[model samples]
Target chain A: METRVDGRLVRGDQTRRAVLGKAVEIASVDGLEGLSIGRLAKELEISKSGLFAHFGSKEELQLATVRAARRIYVTAVVEPALATAPGFSRVWALSECWLDYSQRRVFPGGCFFAKASHEYGARRGPVRDYLAEVNREWVQLVEQTIGEAISLGELEADPAQLAFELNAYYDSANLASLLHDDDGAIYAQARHSIRARLESAATAGTALPWRSGRSR
Target chain B: METRVDGRLVRGDQTRRAVLGKAVEIASVDGLEGLSIGRLAKELEISKSGLFAHFGSKEELQLATVRAARRIYVTAVVEPALATAPGFSRVWALSECWLDYSQRRVFPGGCFFAKASHEYGARRGPVRDYLAEVNREWVQLVEQTIGEAISLGELEADPAQLAFELNAYYDSANLASLLHDDDGAIYAQARHSIRARLESAATAGTALPWRSGRSR
Candidate 1:
């Protein structure tokens, strides 16, 4: 059954979602700075005043777009990895899903966070602060996942350092794919790099994550 | 005596240099697309037509800025590394120089190429093509440096793979610096990673590069 809500509220929510969907796609390629309410409104066939009512200012619009991207990022990249068991296997799944998300053009550019982070990382303001917070959230998730493996005795390394390298591989591959016209092999190379790094850190009896379908 | 040049040509050269100098700084903080003739003219207090004549178009201005950045990059990062005797030492020197360049805020952003490349990586245009070329040149130079180390028998590893990982560290550290407010120690951690990786591949009796002040 549909949740009880005013018809006007439902329509407004739908419109907001539609705007953000287009917003994230534009920001992914042209950057958050490139996202303009006027262009977005025209493209969405909505009134500029209508879109402006959803977000009070350009900065607000950018922040909302970042939040929208975060939700998609969670669904496409994070939730699937979290669905797996917590440990090295889950961490491996996270990398795989991230690579898939980028190469599949989930955002029609690449990872939204990577693009926005670089865009705002050098700037100052509420937008930069929010993007940094999102970045911190993502990095912490990666570190925590690695920590699970270390606790399980499946891996041996500093969680922060491994997180850094793993995240680096993800971003490098994302940028490389964009530059190379979504060349599939870049993802493979990233996978190889991830697998090699993980293999180097895996404990002697730990099952390698890449060799799937074998009973532990 | 002043180098002889046509009086009109000298003024033209001076204007072009001044325009490019501001262009690189703005492009660094705001990406190449953020740079516009209007902004350049307003900021430099030059007429719009004057700035427009220097580059002819926004795309040409971006390419000229990239070229200007390249010259700065060569002087700041590449030349210092090249001055050293080639081989493992030069590879080590290149890493140090790159890290230093980023830490020193050579572009007032992070790395110029990193910012511009991420800006245009997904978009198809002369800007993206030029960025890709710059990226290829940087990566190939890195590979050649690694090759020198391998050929000298001081290091043993696949040059391509090593180049990828090393460049990854450089770019990662640069981005992390932006995110972390130029936290000086990220470079140290990246240095540590670079050293550890090199140590793993280094042959017996090869002196560690970091143990400096000892004449080679």
Candidate 2:
């Protein structure tokens, strides 16, 4: 009896994961407001009642989709950057990974947060609050990474200011690429800006990450 | 008969202008997809058939809204910048105008293009095409303004690259301000980055725009 219950729970988890996998892709293309439980159920071949049992409200589903996108973001952009040595190289890695994440269409439509944040930015709600929290978290991470380079004497700048600039490049490239149906030129432009900004801040005699023979 | 017909024509024009004004506001906040003829008619107290006659279709309305937004953008951001001398100060004016446009909430939600572009970016349609065209137009304007500064020998940088970086800062600040509901700190950060970048590119003898006591 215990085994049967455990099996049911695992299956339920699988279904929920699969549903959110589809949900994030849709939300990336369409806004989170475009997410409809009926449509999701129809697309996923799940009964509407089953979806309701999983997510009691549209807000809940939207929140879950955001959470799912966040996990994918961390894996695709954050984890690899963190794997690098904590200094100028790691900062470069973060930029490279982010460009790849957007260019490669990891979220199908583009960066999930870019789309979702603009969608819900003006509206006041749980979704907006959550997205704001996520953005704050991201900015802090970038600032922290830059601080590592500053502390190591490899770079010199205000971490918060530099982080804001780096993030701007990432988002601009993502939007330009998506809007223009670009063929990689936008990402190249973004890379140029990121490298130049980092170079401007790197201390003299410090080995630049992009210029060095080291792979980032 | 001529007088009556002219009066009717003038009234029709007035109604169309009013409808588009409201439409742009709605699109800025809720996105173009959220603009519904029924809702507009109900809110504006016009007959649905009247709106249908004016717009003909949802696509037409969205396209018209975009056009209207472009006009407002030119007035709010472009014209003011163009009024400045065509040099480093013009480029600086452009940045200041754009930041003001977003900061002052000219569209009540934010820069209409920033929000609308992200909304329709991934989707393929006439709306997306129109948005892409507008974005291209805006980028070219920035590039042209930067070229003027470079030609005047007041700045030294790649026009396209500098345009991309400056525009990135404008958009990033707009998004950050909206998401965080900031108290003007985001704009200050963007201003610092913009000034620093331009200062790096400015020729030694060129007078800095922001630093001068000129009323900008």
Best by lDDT: 2
DockQ of 1: 0.70
Location of the lowest summed lDDT over 10 successive residues in candidate 1 chain A: A207-216
Candidate 1 lDDT tens digits, A1-216: 887879999999999999999999999989998988899999999999999999899999999999999999999999999999988899899999999898888998788988888898789999998888888899899999999999999999988888888888888888877886755877887888888889899988888777876844
RMSD of 1: 2.4
TM-score of chain A of each: 0.95, 0.95
Query: What are the per-model DockQ values?
Result: 0.70, 0.87
For model 1, the superposed segments whose C-alpha errors exceed 4 Å read A1-3, A212-216, B1-3, B212-216
Instruction: Supply the DockQ value of model 2.
Output: 0.87
What shift in Å separates residue A108 of candidate 2 from its native position after superposition? 0.7
The local distance difference test score of model 2 is 0.94
Q: Which whole-number lDDT from 0 to 100 does residue A150 have in model 1?
A: 94
Tens-digit lDDT track of model 2 for A99-216 = 9999999998999999999998898999999999999999999999999999999999999999999999999999999999899999999999999999889998788866657646
Model 2: residues with Cα > 4 Å off, grouped in runs = A1-5, A214-216, B1-5, B213-216
Residue range with the least summed lDDT across 10 consecutive positions in model 2 chain B: B207-216
